[model samples]
Structure formats: structure tokens, C-alpha cells
Target: MSLVRLSIKGISYSQTQNGAYALILNEVDGERKLPIVIGAFEAQSIAIALEKEIRPPRPLTHDLFKTFADRFDIVVKQVIIHKLVDGVFYSSMICERDKIEEIIDARTSDAIALALRFDAPIFTYKNILDKAGIYLNMSSEDKSDSEESDDILSTPETFGNTSSDEEIKNTYAKYTLAELNDLMDQAVQDEDYEKAAKIRDEITKRES
Candidate 1:
């Protein structure tokens, strides 16, 4: 199957599932976005990587992996979202050392997080895209095209959270958007992605 490159678009709380976030991946050369429900930790890790301005005082797991890889002269070449099965994505990390390459199994979220740290491209197979990808309508003339398309399109399948131990409470609705924004920022700073997801979900619910 041919490979289609993808880029990180944004992260938002998954409305269908509590304590999960949608990691939106835009087709590199198309309008479709692949939204995969990932855990809060991966969501925050990906968000921090994308922000480029927020740095944790200590290393995150992904950060430590990056530093360790660099010290050993092992470099990540790219990440591939190789398979989608029963609403789950399987990814692999392509790493190189001493001119030899290796493919390592990884969670799609972890692969993406490390890909960002290493400036690696992300890809998925065309067949997989054909099966699971969601197309969103857009137009340069309509600024509200996004909101309109969201309403017009069929909702893509959403995966559920693995556990309820960290489920986000709905208390966020009592807070204003501004308050949620502050809370989200603080959550990101404190690496509290469950709180961040809850705040984000409330903000998105109000916006929609």
C-alpha cells in the first residue's frame, strides 16, 4: 500500500469519551483529518511538543528517550501509523544507528510524540486512510467552513477509554471559558492532562 504523510493538527478532548483526547492528524496534502482517541498523558506530551514554548522542569518519558537515543547516536528516522484494527492504531518507530536501521513497535501516541522531538515525518497506509480517514469540507471564502463541515459530515468512530480510574468529572461546566482556559494552562504546566481534558471539553462544548 502507498503511504500518505500526515501532520499534527490539534488536540481536543474527546466528547464521546471521558478522560480521553482526540489527537487530530491532518493529511499532509489533503483535507481529511484522522482523529484518534488517546490517553491524557500522550495528549499532553504531544501538546507540549507542538507548543514549542513549554518546557517541563524535568524530562518527560519521551524527552528522556530522546536524550538517551541522542547520547547513543541512535536517531529516529520517521514514524509510521502502520495499522488500524478495531478502532486502534498501531505504529512503529524507524530508528537508525551505525548506518543500520530498526523498526520498533510503539503506541501510535508515543510514536507521534517521539516523531515530533526528532522532527520525523508521520505516515499511514493509503488503504488504512481509505477505511478510517474522515474528510472535512473547507473553503477559503467561508471562515465558518470548519464549524459547518463538522455539522454536515458523518461523525467518525470514537474509541473508549481503557479505565475509569482517571475519568474526568463534569464539574468543568460550572466554570467560564476564561476560567477553563486558565485551568487548561495550569494543567498543562502541572502535567495534569485529565484536568486539561475536562477543561477543554467544557470549552469546546460551549463553543459548539
Candidate 2:
């Protein structure tokens, strides 16, 4: 299987699945996109990594991993989203330490997050992309913040894409950082990482 380079197109909340978010990846040389469903905590971690200006008061799990990897001289050379089974995407981190390289299994979300922090490239198998990739009617790069908040992406029949109206219409903008943190804790306790991610986005927006 040949590898295709990919870049983060955007992240959007899943209207069809509560607490699920879509991590959109675009092929660097093609219009095909791979949208992987991920948990809210992973979404928040990825978004935080992308937003170079927004620093969290504490390190997130991905951040901690990045710090530890850096300290030990384990550099992530690249991340590969290699498989899709039952709608779940599997990824591997291609890391090197002491002039030796190894591949480590990881959730697609976490792999991408660390890739961003390490400035490592991301890739996916061409066969996998051909299986799950779709050509959106609209460009992923053109999606606005409001559109992301709203749910407007579609994948053609070849790809299995969920469909539904946008859920959780409330904007967390009105909540203060402390309130958002409390809500984040509650969301975690309730295992509602999606809501926690939305709150995290709102907090990041305020800081930006």
C-alpha cells in the first residue's frame, strides 16, 4: 500500500453522534478527504495543539506526551493513519531515538496531536483513503467557524458518513473560564467529552 500525505483540514462536531467530533484530513495532493470520528477530549487536544497562540493553564495528555518524548530524545518523524475498522481509524507514530526508529500504535487523534507538536508529517495509506475518502461538495478549507459549529459536511456513498442535524445548539461563549472548567469536569464525570470539547473551544476563543 502506498502512502499519501495528509493535512488537517478542520475539526467539526458530529451532528449525528452526540459527543463525537469529525477530524477532517485532506490529502496533500488531492481533493479526497478522510473524516475520522473522535472523542471530545481528543478533539480539544488536537485543537489546542493547532492553536499555537492558546496555551492551556496545564498540560494536556498529548502535551505531556510531547514533553516527555522531547526530553527523552524520541522524535516523532511522522504519523500514519493506517487502518479503518468498523468506522474506527488506527494510526501509528514513527518515532526515532538514539538513531533507531520504531512504530507505535496510537489512536488517530492522539497521533495527529503529537504530530503537530513535533512538526512531524502525517500520512495515510492510499488504499484506506480510496475506501473512506470523499470529495466534499465544498472545500474543507472554506468552512467557517459558524459552519463548523453547524453540521454541513457530506460524504458520498462510497464512504460511510453519518447524517443528522446539529445537536447542542447552546454557545459556551457566555460561560466564564472557571465556569467552563467546572462544566468540563462535569462533562468528564458524565463522560460527555463532546460538551467538554465545546467548552474548551470557547475557553480557547476567549484567550485568543
Candidate 3:
């Protein structure tokens, strides 16, 4: 199978599942994006790693793993998202130490978070991308229209795994698009990404 390199796009809260997030991966040389649902802690860990400016007072679990690996001289070479079964992604980490290499199984979210810390490249089989990737239309002339299209295209796929947790209620339904935009900006300024994501979803819903 041919491998395609991928890069972090961003993370957003799942609209349909409580405490779940969608991790978006962009094909490095293509237009498609791979969205995988991940848990809250993993999402936050990956977010912090991506931001590079927010340092947690204590090392998060992934951070501890990186520290431990450094102490042992283990180096992460790359990450491979090797499989997709029932809406879940499976990944492997290529690590090397003392001129020997090892492959370690990892959750897609965890693998990605560690990849950011280690500056490791991420790759997935072309077949996997064909099966799960989504494309965004970027040729539109209107900027807002293009962004709206992107949000619509990047929605999370639950794949029958959503639990019984009641979805977050829509309190912004009454607000106009203009007001919602202001609220979204405020949410982002407050660093409430989950709230910002929900607002963005509401705006997208209205736009669509």
C-alpha cells in the first residue's frame, strides 16, 4: 500500500457527542482531510502541543511519555495511521534507540500528540484516505462562503459509536449570525475552544 503524508489541521469539539472531539488531519500534498473522533483529554493534549505557547503547569501524560522516552534515548521517527475499523483509527509509532528500531501501537490521537512533541511526520495508507477522507471546495470567491463550506465538510463522523449522553442543547439558536459571530470571537478570546466550536457549528447550521 502506498503511504500519504499528513499534517495536523486542527481539533474541534464533537457536536453530537459529549466530551468527544474531532481531530482533523490534512493530506500534505492533497485537498482531503481525515477527521477522527477522539476523547477530551487527548484533544486538549493535542491542542496544547499544537499551540506551542500554552505550557501546562504539570506535564500531561503525553508529555511525561516524551520525557521518559528522552531519558531512555528513544526517538520517535514517524507515526503511521495503519487501519480504520468501525470509525476508529489505529496507528503505530516508529521509534529508534541505539541503532535499533521498534514499532509501537498507539491510539490515533495519542500518536498525533506525540508526533507533535517529537517533530515526527505522520502517514496513512492511501487506501485509508480514500475510504475516510473528505474534501473541501476552496475555489469559491466569497471568503465566508468558503469558510462555511469548510465547516460543513469537516464535520465529525460518529460511525454508530455515539453514546447515550444527551447532546449539548442549542442555546444560540435564537441569535442572528452576526451575534453568533461575536460570541464565537469572545469564546475564542476566552480560550474556550469547545464553546467556540459549538458556536461555530450553530453558525454553520444557520448558514447551511
Candidate with top lDDT is 3
- The TM-score values for the models, in the order shown, are 0.70, 0.67, 0.70
Question: What Cα-based lDDT does every candidate model obtain?
Answer: 0.71, 0.69, 0.72
In candidate 3, residue 72 scores what lDDT? 97
Residue pairs whose backbone atoms clash in candidate 3: none
lDDT of 3: 0.72
Model 3: per-residue lDDT, tens digit, 1-208? Answer: 9999998767666666687886778899997767676778888888888877889999999999999999999999999999876445689999999999999998887898899999999999998887666554345465355345333112223322233223423476567889988886675444344455455555544664
TM accuracy, model 3:
0.70
Provide the clash count, candidate 1: 0
Clashing pairs in 2: none
Ranking by lDDT: 3, 1, 2
- Please identify model 3 stretches exceeding 4 Å from their true place: 140-208
lDDT of 3 at 59: 100
Q: Where does model 1 exceed 4 Å of error?
A: 143-208
| TM-score-based ranking | 3, 1, 2
Q: For residues 19-127, what per-residue lDDT tens digits would candidate 2 score against the true structure?
A: 6676767789986666666777888888887778889999999889888988999999999988765445678999999999999998777888899999999998998
Q: Candidate 1 residues 88-112, lDDT tens each?
A: 6789999999999999999888999
The lDDT of model 1 is: 0.71
Q: After best superposition, candidate 1 residue 84: deviation in angstroms?
A: 1.1
